[model samples]
Target: MSTPPPRRASAAVASPTAPLIGLGAGAPVLAFDVGGTDIKGALFGEDGHIRCLARIPTPVAGDRTGQAVIAEIVNLAGRFAEVQPSVNPRALGLVVPGHIDTRSGTAVFAENMGWKDVAFRERVSALTGLPVHFGHDVRAAGGAEFRLGAATGLRDVVVVVIGTGIAGALFVDGRPYDGDGLAGEIGHAKVASGPTCACGGTGCLEAVASAAAIARRYSALTGAQVAGAKEVLDRSQAGDPDAKLVWKDAVDALALSFSHVVALLAPEAIVVGGGLAEAGPALLSPLTARLDEYLTFQRRPRILAARLGENAGLLGAAIGARELMVAGGTR
Candidate 1:
């Protein structure tokens, strides 16, 4: 008994306009993420500069395919208004992962684009008249790494991305914590012990440390065939004892899910980002020595890395559609 969404069945009413502030004041906030293959789109420009970035693909599921992925971002906002007609890009921001209810812009579920409860900001502001801003792609890249990357000033953070599937985004003083929107779904929480997880959960942490579960658990444990997850961190840097036991069991299940999110959010830092955090320091020196051997009394945090690569959820959906144009609500 909880369906009623499909853009409120076309009560379509979008023209309220409101969205513009900073990034240099209007004419370039059209970011979109919406994954499960692709639909990236971008245009940030008011000198903060991103431009017409594109991706495409994502259109196979059902229920009018979430208004056909908002009519392909209203045809990529009419090709970003004919490939930048002097950059007067009104305003639109969107990021999507799953279960987002950010104050009813809906999309209550999205298991890899098989959507449900979809309103997606009044059908993308009624087909791109603009003012769309919606979120939850890893809590808008953990609110763009707590406002400007790598847990900026850091006051209780937890960005985590570990991509091809894995999620994060939590913060306290720097803000972003949305418990009512089901706080950062921490990649389905459970720290893997068996398998099962397509969010039906069992041993989650994205089914044991994601990057497509370390290339499907090292091709289901050595039947050969490897490609992604940087070739299991390049055959565990060429030593290769089954790629160092699947890179030490995906960095000890991501340092035991960062020691249960640093003993339940005492976060001072934990940024890490997608594409296996490019295994820098072989993935931060053994995930800081297995998060200091899975902490004892807490206070650890400081894991860092993600300095907004892959456009940090399109610059946090253009800073949340420039914060709904600084709260005038799509003014």
Candidate 2:
């Protein structure tokens, strides 16, 4: 069976949110990075250029959560088709945050997204009649970094994304090392026996060091509600004593976690991404110093901000889609 030719879209890309860089010639593919709140969708042309980028609010559909998200993805594919009927995408890369089993293309679970046991790859492939490649969001984003961004040329790397929550993607010997979708869960590493994490685990690193945690910790300390971690960071920079204390604690927890990663994985580079990485030197400088104090005769990773920003996951999704086409896999 063949797909009917899609109608041409009137305008190219209405909202070009991310830049088209680093991507060269490759198969045309549709890509999506579904988060707990927002979903990023992109259309890549045969030239490996991003032709369209759109941010869509994820639907909160209670028990129908996975089904609702899949419906939205199918709808987005149609919308992308209308933009350029001539450029029919052959494959799709869909990444979602959770305990994803890429081997079976199953989304095992996501606490925030309210989904479990969703065979995303099979569902998307059957619905759109396009080969679908699925993966974990953080791991996919880490792949983009390993191939094209901050960790480029490094054989061993860890891509850490510090947003509302924190997660990591591990790369060793120039390849992603996913221990059956459970490898790089650095965020859950016990850094201190303090706050309870969302994962119901005590002393999880993200509970203390993540962007949301930083803001919450600051608000608890100073009795002042902050907009986000950036606000807390700014307050700290402006000589706010409470803010400084919160920030320092977060850094210390992060360093403690990284020290473990360095000692274990021994990644040469730890490329940081997401909202907290926006702090640049403010975060890395302190983190490096703290990590140094923890290690003796251990390789200190060169920490840097991710170049692709939020688009790293989207690019990783695109790469996965194109690979599917190359492998001649289709539903």
lDDT (CA) for every model shown?
Answer: 0.76, 0.87
- Candidate 2 regions off by >4 Å? 1-18
Candidate 2 residue pairs in clash (backbone atoms < 3 Å): 9-82
Best by TM-score: 2
What TM-score does candidate 1 reach?
0.35
Candidate 2's TM-score reads 0.94
Determine which window of 10 residues in candidate 2 has minimal summed lDDT: 3-12
Best by lDDT: 2
RMSD (Cα, Å) for all candidates, in order, is 16.3, 5.3
Clashes of each: 4, 1
Task: Quote the RMSD, in angstroms, for model 1.
Answer: 16.3
What digit string (tens of lDDT, one per residue) describes model 1 on residues 1-331? 3433433122111221334222444556788888777667777777656656676677764556677778877877777668677777667889888777777788888766777898888878876777888887778867876777777777778888888877777888767777877766677878767688876878887777788877788888887778887887888788878878877877887898888878877888888888789777888889889889989877877788887766688778888887777685762
Give the C-alpha lDDT of model 1: 0.76
Model 2 Cα shift for residue 54 (angstroms): 0.8
